[model samples]
Target: MRGGEAATLEAVLQSVEDPEIPVVSVVELGIVRGLDAGQVTITPTYTGCPATAVIEANIREALDQAGFEDIQIKTVLSPAWSTDDITDAGRQKLKAYGIAPPPKGAKAASLCNKSVAECPHCGSINTREISRFGSTPCKALWQCNSCHEPFDRFKCH
Candidate 1:
């Protein structure tokens, strides 16, 4: 693609929101890994998550509507995806939506130790996991000790 065409494709893709998490865009979720002449490479947040297909369909629809129907959407799972891949803007969006963002570098430590999830409402670290699963498989249900507010925390990958 020409420079201008590539930039337009990116802008269109960035405008596509995550089907499951409407508050954040697919770009902010780190789903759009690369763009080429007529292809978009993406890595879904989770392999088995039900939203993966919806996300791709949304992107496809958006691209088609934007008059870039020729652009192909490709899924690449080799490297996998980490919560750490989420952009800072995405993290803020999640917090604003009452979902706790995973801590920096928590992805590596999550396997060995429990990472304290900060309360998005009260900014308290004293939170307890209510369940390993939240509204979605990619999150955990947690309650803040300080505010007693239950919220969803993005799971560490």
Candidate 2:
């Protein structure tokens, strides 16, 4: 691809929104791993997530519509995706969407330790997990004691 084509492709790919979370794009969610001359690499957030196929399909359709039909979408499973890969802007967006973003660093260990998650609505640390699973497989249901509001929290992985 020419330099201009590559730049355009990058921009287009960056703008592709996540199907499950419209507020965040695939790039912001850290799914778009790399962009090359005619290839776009991605790593799904969850292994068995139903949204994985949707994400790939959306990217494919976007690329095709952008006149980059020759570009290939590759899924990279190695270096498995972690919540830490989510960009700062993505975390902010998630919070603004009323979903608590995962804490940075030691994701697996922190979750195992039952780290307190701040309430997305009231910013209270006094929250409890209502369910291990939330509306999505990647999130957990939580309720804020202060505001008595229920929210979904992106699970640390």
Q: Output the number of the TM-score-best candidate.
A: 1
Residues 7-120, model 2: lDDT tens digits: 898889888999989999999999999998579999988888999999999999999999988999999998888888899999999999999999888465755426788999
Q: For residues 1-157, could you state the per-residue lDDT of candidate 1 as single tens digits?
A: 7888888888888888888889999999988888975799988887788899999999999899989888898999967788888999999999999999887676677542257888999899999999888888788899999999999999888
Q: For each candidate, what is the lDDT?
A: 0.87, 0.89
Residue 24 lDDT in model 1? 94
What candidate 1 gets wrong by more than 4 Å, as runs, is 110-113
TM-score of each: 0.94, 0.93
- Cα deviation at 111, candidate 1, in Å, is 3.9
- Best candidate, lDDT-wise? 2
In candidate 1, position 110 carries an lDDT of 57
TM-score of 2: 0.93
